[model samples]
Target: MLTPWRLFLCQMALNIFYHIAKEIGEMESKWRLLHKANIKLCSQLIFTFITWQMSGYLTTKNSSLCLGGQDIFATVRENSPTGEIIAHLSINGDPGASSIRLCLTGENADWFYLEGRTIRLNSSFSRTLDREVLGSVLIAALTCYEDDIIRSRYRIMVEILNENDNMPYYLEDTIQPRYISELLTVNSMVFTVKARDGDGDTITYMTDKSTADASYFRIDLPNSGMVILDKPLDYETKTQLQVVIFAVETTTKEKYSTTATVTVNVLDGDDQYPQFQPCAPVYEDGDHNICTNPVYSVNITETDEDAVLYFSPGPIHAEDGDKDILTPLVYSILSGDGNGRFTIDSKTGEISLRQRVENRLLTPSFRLRIMAAQVNDPKKYSVATALVHVVSENRFPPFFNKTVYKGFLIESSSPATLVTTYGNQVLVVQAIDRDFRDGINPKIHYTMQPLTGSNKLYHISQDGIVIAKTDRLRAFDRHILEVIATDEESGETAHASVDIEVLQRGQPVPRSPFGEERLFGDMNAGMAGGIAALVLLVAVTVLFLFLWLAKRRRERRDPADRGAVALGKHPNVEASSPIAPRHVL
Candidate 1:
């Protein structure tokens, strides 16, 4: 703190320099002819002002002068028995209030005393200022400076707060429907309803309808707000049910109840067995063995509350009501075959024959009882009775003997005698009856004739003739005769015929050809010549090979021969030049 008293001394020195520079300025303008002298005087005044402005260092060093917002205690000494008066500003430094200016009012307050004022200590200077008679003073600028010096010891603190500003709801609203069987046990996880919140905060769960098992449902973990079913579900008794859920926030405990209907549809399980209604009986019509048509109208039906199941029947389950447990009404067989050839529709309960019956040995009418089994339950069967009636139709056609015999003649050559050829002709009949021969008759009849050039005439004896009728016939001739048998009821008949051709008994006669003949008979001469030419070519090839071999041997033996000489010289010339000379010398 620079004392006001010291500041007074510095103010007086500053005023003196101020007045001297003002005087130098006034004198320099007045003495223009003494320009060099005026210039040096101006320079001296400028240097003096700069030195005085920087003179604070020589007075108080580097200590700060505290001024505002501080508390301090100051004291002043008037009479100094110890040779000089020292105005010591001693501050009771409160760490909280380091320094502050306090206007200390007192008597004789003519001087505002600044602290740390250095006055020259001398006997005469100390004589007027008293030391022991010191008085209290105010710490003005000095108090503030001390406050800054103590500020680093204390620290400041602050804080913020929380608020409830979030909302509670499921992030996803829609959910899928779940299906389960009514037969499921309790505590089974049929489905889990999940929900979420945008705030990532804790969430809660509730139920819209609390009347039925609502307490079992609740959100499980953190954000997994899911509804769990605590009981079993059944579809047969209860087809479908809705589970309404309400979501809430765990933190704020605020809830917005949204009824997301979790549909629990119960599915059908294997519950109902099949059952069947009764069917009608089957019958037969016409001759028993020839009956080829089935007759019946017996249908099988079934029903169940859970599900209408299938129906089935076995071979014993005939179309005839005699075999059925329940006979059909108003549906009767018009014409039926007695064979085991009938069936009934299990699902539609429509009774009809399996196929058009076709078998011999089967009865014309059937006294059968059709038995039908339930589609869902094959063990349960029912049966009914049928009365079969057989009607007689056309009898089977009559059959004749398969073999037919023709008469033979024993005659000599020219003017032959009439032989008994008719006696060799046997008209035999063996007829069969499909109706087991119900009093039917079969007979044989015959007539005879002799061929032309015959000598004697003969006649049938009326007991199946053995003689020929030469007067009405020619000798050595050909003829055909037939005998027929028929069923008396159907008029269906069968016949057998004899074909007679009288043959002369001797060696056969030879005949001559019509056109021309050659040496090779019917063979073509040009074709034969071509074959001879091929043979000649093969002979010539063999001969040429033999001659070539013979000539080659002769040339090898005769080395001096002309051909051998030519062969040797030809190779020499060819070896010398590949091109052969046009004319050899």
Candidate 2:
């Protein structure tokens, strides 16, 4: 015999089967019906079936069987084994019901099974789901049955909460190489890092503190995996940097992380000026100022016929302080090169003469001012000077200013007499070297050759000055003196004959047209006396003028009382002037 509760559940089960068959038939004919009508009917049937199933399980009038009304949640580990109980389901009014059975049905019913009141995994369950089948939230219908009949139907939601089983790893195993200029501003974007977690957990990016200093960089978390430069970089100090980046799960208690190496190559920039190597210590001038730049000396002789005259004076070198190593430098002649005789390599600091020096006798020495600058920035530079000394081979002899020089002296003139003043330079003979572009030659010296005379009458000074040795000669007498100009280095010589004419005391000298002899003693005495008399006259005139001006000022103050005279008068005299006149007389 079937009980009333049993019979009611049996009827509900038949109703459920009928509704499910009808839904299938409607689905096949769904295209034929109006879209709205079909949807409305399907919804009504679903709601009625759920209501009927709930009402069958409630035995008492006050008992309620909530279908999708009461919230149900279950947490399951990802990839759980089949038949693993996730959570137990309970009907509100059921306690110790021997005939009650739990059945799972819905879109994801295939993934779970029901055992009495417990919900267990029927198949291997993965947290990762396809939206077409089952979304992130697993919804199923948990139905209580009695004797193979539906009693109550409840909608349950199984949320597969993620666990830290899967570690976070970088999307790319290695980061792409990034190039950043040393001059890049701080807080600039360097590169981005991307990471993924199979468990769908929030991932945080960070730099490995042990690998490199994290102070110079910062990482954006969660969605954005961008890395930025927190501080400036210098290529000179460090050329390349490797930063280890870690991607970690934010919710994991353990330190589960994935690492990737980011190679940051610092590029060179034009930030530093060129610095020249310090030359030899240079002495300061008298005024404590650097009179000369760094000097490099090179000796070139006439016999030296090398094809390339390398300027090895001091190997010019310049370095860019901003670069990790010395960069390319350019060399140029800044000044002191009047002629285009030398050229230097722009990349290398090697300097060479463009043309060979045919004659070193003329130009014994010269100087050149050279500049070294970085190739990147030419304006940033340093300057140095080089002195080139030449050794002559005496290809040409010295030449005199004049072939014949005429001189005059007074007859019986005293030794070292004022024949010619060094300041005036009357009897000067200049010798020049044709080998040099500049006519003046410092090597050639002047001297008087041996003359046919008992005593050396006259001699030529090194500076080409003719001086008389003694005061012994006759009037109208003449002497011919030969001045030999010799080159100290080349041993070459040239001579010029100087003709000297003697004159009497009154006769005019040949070269001294202004009459060089003068009585300086008398002239000086006259000049002194004239100056003293003029000073005395000026003093007397000033004193007389001062006295006359004083007398005129006194007269202007007392004009009317100039000639009046006062006489003493007796006190008792009655007449006005009889006693006064006697006293006055």
Error of 2 at 547 (Å): 99
- What TM-score does candidate 2 reach? 0.42
| Per-model TM against the reference | 0.23, 0.42
Cα displacement (angstroms), candidate 2, residue 558, comes to 99
C-alpha lDDT score of every prediction, in listed order: 0.42, 0.66
What is the C-alpha lDDT profile of model 2 across 1-585, one tens digit per residue?
A: 334555455456545655676778855344334333444445555556756867875643254432222446876655556887867665653434655556678887777875655668766445433332343567788776665666567777777655556678776643887888999998788888888876677788878767654666887544587888887887766778888888888776875788888889999877766655543435655422222334666666756543344444346566676645566788888875547766667777666665667777777776887787876667777788777667755567788878877676665556675344222347777798888778667878888864545257676777777777546666666677788988765657888887766655654443344645432332455687798899999999999999999998877864333423122334343445456655756
Tens-digit lDDT track of model 1 for 84-178: 33233333333234253323223422233333322122234433432213222221222223433432111111111122334544445345776
Report the number of clashing residue pairs per model.
Answer: 54, 1
Runs in model 1 with CA error above 4 Å? 1-160, 179-184, 196-201, 210-226, 229-232, 236-239, 250-259, 265-342, 346-349, 353-585
RMSD to the hidden true structure, all candidates: 38.5, 25.7
Which segments of model 2 are wrong by more than 4 Å?
A: 1-82, 86-104, 123-136, 142-154, 194-205, 212-231, 248-252, 272-297, 302-307, 313-331, 338-364, 372-377, 392-585
